[model samples]
Target chain A: MNGSIADPKAVRRTILRNLRSALLELGSATKAELSDRLGVSFPTVSKFLGQMEKAGELLPVQLDDSSGGRRANRYSYNPEVMLGLALFLERTETSYIVFNCAGEVKDQGHAASVLTADITDFDALIAALVNKHPQISAVSVGVPAAVNNGRLIYIPEYEQFHDLDLKAHCEQRFQLPTVIENDMNAAVYGYYMARHQRSELQPSLVYLYFGQNGPGSGIMLDGNIMRGSSFFSGEVSFVPLYDQYNFGEAMRASHPHPRFPDGDLSVDAVARLIAVFAAVLNPHGVILSRHEANEGLLAQLEAASQAYIPREHLPAFILSDWEQDYLYGLQGLSLDLMLSREAGGN
Target chain B: MNGSIADPKAVRRTILRNLRSALLELGSATKAELSDRLGVSFPTVSKFLGQMEKAGELLPVQLDDSSGGRRANRYSYNPEVMLGLALFLERTETSYIVFNCAGEVKDQGHAASVLTADITDFDALIAALVNKHPQISAVSVGVPAAVNNGRLIYIPEYEQFHDLDLKAHCEQRFQLPTVIENDMNAAVYGYYMARHQRSELQPSLVYLYFGQNGPGSGIMLDGNIMRGSSFFSGEVSFVPLYDQYNFGEAMRASHPHPRFPDGDLSVDAVARLIAVFAAVLNPHGVILSRHEANEGLLAQLEAASQAYIPREHLPAFILSDWEQDYLYGLQGLSLDLMLSREAGGN
Candidate 1:
């Protein structure tokens, strides 16, 4: 681009942006690969690579086999270049973690949450984390409710959180870009990214979080979170059972005794929900997250699915990791924000 | 581009392709708009417009108002440039229609189909249509089955259609590009395009077809069909009912009568599913197609949805057009193949 010489500063910025994107996409790239991929001269790439390396934005890794000629160096994005703070809010407690650009945990904290929960102590915790790691560039949060463009529209468990705009609060307090997502959406996104690393796992998946109160699902089609018009697409708790009794009916005091025992596991309602997923979305994998999906429950679910779906067409069922999935999702959101800031420059 | 002194043929091809694309995207464009959109010189755009008009691929239209001063000519895609042959195969009979690029009907045909009915007479019908309209560029077929990469993988109601590789057969016999889509899939796609044009309908939608033997659904998330792995998504007949009996169980002769009359409607099951859709996917609208979705049925569905979903959160319920929605879907598919060929060129 500089060869045309229209504007030196603009071309330099473009070159740097392209270089960063190339390295991040490929995980690591040789100087020749960077030049070929970016349509830039090798010398310009080398000059920028050297500059970025000195600025602590890029790192050089020597190849394992170079044929003993001039040593070939592969460049990688510096994992520690920036930190992302993630907060997951539950009814009783709020948990937080700091992760680097590569999603590796650097620090962690927690504070109790209640109906009276406010940003006072939360602000203190964020301030402490930022004081320890001044490089934090973004914050991501997950809440148990319906969120639409950063505002909490509904939180049955915590009425105080309703209509709250946590994104603005975090941005103002931490002086960083912020994002708030539905807890179910975050967990499923995390699960998909983790499972997708395996070549055999299909890219499309649905994560059903069978909870104590009801069920909620998160959908990933073609590796993108399927955020609906209101950004509240995955609120599955409201799904009715085959009868007038919806999943939420289980929580009602006057609800009749369950036809199937064992809670969310091995329940007829859960199996019917799974059947709906199998027939409707036909995701490659349907993960039952946040529940003790034991082998017995798996057998019953398999049997129920067989009765409805063709045996040959049943999606693979797996129990998801209960604890780390949300954190993984938060990290994924953090990385997205950090990288998108460069592409969008805001 | 031609000013760069590049090969004139490649430049001409590029110019024609860009002009056609701009007109299609904008519905209509003047020479100035073409120059601005394509980043081509006005003279170059005007020259290509003249050439394309001569070739009958472009048509010039006068604006509604000219005011009698240097009237500008608006160019539109020649709707009659090529024809798209669409065949909708059903249980008792097969119907065919030929549409132009603008999805206007040009010709139509039909043939009877039975258990032993093969494509022998259907092939003759197709050949006759092609013989009459040699400009036909492609063929699209809709079948009631689970399709995977142009192969019919399952059709429990019609076993003969199973594993049928209709795309290759049509491609070889007609010498035209061919596409085979699920019938329900096409209907919802057509429904979306129809409603999408009105500006009042929500873009994301789910179309439920409660047929006599089975029920199936089609989903449109973010304006794209949600074709799951194996192209088998939206086979809603396989969804498990809340009771021991699933939807497919109705096919089993030994199975007892349905617990609720009217088949999944005016029943808790219908309400439950509506609530599920209301909360889970949060689509803008839900259209009940090909069913006796009368006022009573609508009342039941609305009440069911309202029980779990907040009144404000429910999607609009529409009694979809049964007869022409599928044809509209076929037209949409035909137009897509026609436009995509110009864009993808393969």
Candidate 2:
């Protein structure tokens, strides 16, 4: 069996494929176990393992004792061998991070530049990261807009981002796969991943990201992100709750005094604006975050939300404690997409 | 192989199992092909086919011709071998239907009984169905409420449905498998199944079902339903939309009524209610149905929804034209579950 495969590329692909299958099934596996399960000759498996180790694809772990025989060399995929880059672009700042395959944050970076400044600046920032870290395998960007087939369709106040080919630009620069998702959708994915890992809660989730602009929601049904037809399903800002006159006036009204003289309304004011919206679009819970969300604010919003429940039926409200790490969530989404493909053989 | 199996029960189970497997892999095998694939003697296969025919589980189709030989008998699974009953219970009426395995409607029944009505009446209705159609293999009931682990936690205005052992009661009386799901979740499933069969859309969906009470949402991510922590994630009615008020009340206040009495709302009132909800939660598209959404009502709702979206971005709304047969969707879910199990086994 070892001599059966002649092409080196085919052998490498086969080894990677088998290793992925083993990892997916058992989370980890030893070389001997993989050899037996894959029905490949032991020496062939050993050779592939050695090559993977040399390429930093597999890390040799401590040898496990065998029954009355020599110890077997145990190996696992190197988490750091490949990296994912995720960027969460807010109206005020851009949050970015590097994540390994196991979903651990390896490095983090942020820049306080308005996303609407210029597309060239955004490209430069991403290029700087790629130059700084060569191990990145994929890049995911989350923006506050409606995305249709990886294209930016609408960005409310930021008309500059409309029709931007963010995915193509990133992929062209880094020569890696790229994903561009709505900021709210990314928040939903981030919350879902964090909850799944840290809590024993049910896997289904409806995540509402309350920012100053408005509220955006993401639905996770049966542990999968629910993107509706046209990829704009979670847009909760349009639901009508108040008189069109009052709602429009409130939206256009000047920010109250010195706090926002620049006229950039704070999330709190947006929360108030959405309070009227909330009365109409009652959700399971509303999550507030400014890149990062705190428990105190969540509690405050939760209490405030209670006043709106007409029939004394208040849904649970949770404040996200996770670092306003929208980038990490994008990394998780990429990893999820990869893992799902591997698991389902699609 | 037939001689090797002595037990009649084993034979019956094997026939069922084989027939199901063959039907699932429709184009992959023929009766003769299955006979060879299962490694059963051809005569045994023939005999089992005969028995299944008597049981209405197998139907003889056109024969396949072998070169210069007698045409081989071709048999396929009879879709009507088993039946599923699906009941969608709303505040005002109950929509019920029976479906065959192929998702075709066999029969349907509707009643204008409120969900707040006595459980005994609901039971009586179910009993009447069982008496009328003794061949129903399973029953699935969809209610507009929050369910946690198969337990009804809340039913909003219909308090009588709260804490009801819906599953146990149905199963006990019919001695068949029964499942009770959130109505919105079931609606999403029905919508997804219908669209999947027609388009190349991604399997993940955020389904919003608009009604007078409020909009119900179901998240189907990656071909599976996402149930929230308490199995209530998709409960859109609780999502705070306007000025911290529930969307339902906000819509009522925003769109003042002259039609219905101050408190009692009509279907038109509900339609107006949904129009406001649709604006806030701009899902992929809103699905509208009458008491039991028919073709005419669906078109009307689609036309009405267009008014909500500014003349610029009106994504195509989908009308679920899947025969108005809830039972078929139930069967599809069951079949999908079974196929997933089989795929997992492989």
Candidate 3:
């Protein structure tokens, strides 16, 4: 068999890719540790690390402690490679967070609602942000609306933004790639990606997000977000909860019931939703986000499962920390955009 | 440029592959029709058709009469090229049907029951069928049970079949590849494939099968059947109807209330389920089988959608022909298995 030498450019790219992955996973690493972890020789690692540093891909942080010999410099990923603006539009507030390539928050601010009453304020905000940070690679917006192909299909209190085509509008104005997703769908995507990094998540799960607006689902099949035929999937807010139980009254402000039905996260509603999820889709697990999930709700869901589903067929119910998962989702998408640019031989 | 000659073996395989696909789609065709459709020489088509005919892969069914020229022989794909015993286990009676590579029904019969009580009888039945047809390709069984890894994880009526290891048992007994699927899962798969052939179905839809045993859901995403986390995605019978109503009573024969909650499909149980499906998944359409679905039910569902979901967010409700969807599903699976064998370079 003839021994062939590997391509030097390919080898260098592989080394860079491995180093970047390790940095992302570990947050920070020293040259010696990276060499040991990547199974590359110290001199070769040092050579590539020097080149990467010159290329502005790695940044030197503090030096690592050494026993006696000279200390090695600890390096963190150079997040300034690309910038992304993540806009999380809720019912009453539109939160904007800017993150560099490293998925670290660099800048953030909160503003008045931009989508419910009108999209004029949102248009102004984007124009100002684009002028402020012309270096941003992409813009991602997550809104509390039923989105289908970048158009707002429904948002009870925010009918003015219907058929806005905000994604197209943003792209046309900014000249940078922009993505607009339903807030709950984005959250579900972020939750799936986060749980998958730990390697404990199943290939399929549904994340139920209940916010000030209402309940919605983010369905992940094989760890990817599922947008139905028209991208109208996961509108859980409209899920009819027992026609006689005044579930609709919660939606109507006039005949207001407990806000639990309107994202209160109480007992019967959660239990019934879990049962329906189990019986309908049988996902490995269900993740509840931004809900008042407590031990009482968990107990009721489990006890009810015993009556409806078999002992073995019950799905695990998980309560997510009330963090801005939509921001994480936006950052993830921004990273994908940056990677696609590289894949296209940028 | 060097002109490459097609290998006769690959060419003949391609011809056979195309012919098989056409037969599955069109049901039957003549040699002249196939030649014209496939853009092959008439002589070549005749040569290969002759070989396939001799090998029982196809059969001469009827004659295509001509005005002046000699009458041509119309050939239909032989329904016994590769036989598959498809068993659809219901509550009381187990229906069996056999199909060929073209998914045409060959032979069928059913015993009193299978997998509900004991596997001893099922084992004997399988053994008898094996003896009856040694040329059978595979055996596909669809059981009314929530299956996890080919084992019955949940079955309300037949708790005895829980953890039965049914697929392994059939494989060991028949010495052939076997597949055991949730009854509703297969029905959904079958329904999806059948509708997709006509190119009129949606990319995402759910088939609700209400059998005598209970209700089950078959979810299809992008024309593919989705078996959630542990193959337990579609156990719709467990869906809670109301916060206070006894929806589980219908499943428990002893605690039977007035068949349905309130016996009025307009408000509580049925409408809510449809509304929930529309809100949560937003599938393009919903197919209802084995139910007393009528125009009144449709009117009520539309009215409820107006109350819960947006006008544009409603899914078209379809009533399935109450024949046997599970049988169609089993036939589809068996056909796939046979084609896979051929694709593996058999």
- Candidate 2 residue lDDT tens string, B1-346: 1222133455445544655656644633456676656656567667766666676666656777675977776677666656667777777688788776666778887887648677787888878887787766777777777766456878777776778777877777767667777766666677766546421454544555555666566655555565644454455555443333344444445444333345343233334334544444334444544444667655565565454445233444555533342344555554543322211121
Ordered list by TM-score, greatest first: 1, 3, 2
TM-score of chain A of 1: 0.80
List, residue by residue over A1-346, the lDDT tens digit for candidate 2.
1121133454455555656546544556777787766666577678767766776666657777776888876677766666678887888788788877777788887887547697888888878887787777678888877776578887778877778877887777767678888876677677766545421344444565545565566755444565654455555555443323123333445445343456533333434433433333333444545454566665665565445433243345565633453555687666643432221121
Q: What does candidate 3's lDDT look like per residue over A280-320, in tens digits?
A: 66777777653556666676768866766676666787777
Judge candidate 2 against the unseen true structure and give its global Cα lDDT, from 0 to 1: 0.58
Q: Give the B-chain TM-score of model 2.
A: 0.63
Q: What is candidate 1's TM-score against the reference?
A: 0.82
Better of 1 and 3 by lDDT: 1
**Lowest lDDT 10-residue stretch of candidate 3 chain B:** B1-10
Candidate 1 lDDT by residue in tens digits, B1-346: 1122223455556666556656766788888887876677789788778866777687657773475787788878887788899988888788899988777898886678632476677688788888999888888888887677677777776666678887888888878888888887788888888656422434778888767656778888877788887666777556554555554453333343355554533345555565666666777888886355777778777886686778777778888785588888887777666654543233
Candidate 1 local lDDT, A164-268, one digit each (tens): 888887777667888888887788788876655422444777887767666677888777777665655666656555444555464343344454444442365
Clashing pairs in 1: A239-B276, A242-B269, A243-B268, A244-B268
DockQ of each: 0.38, 0.20, 0.28
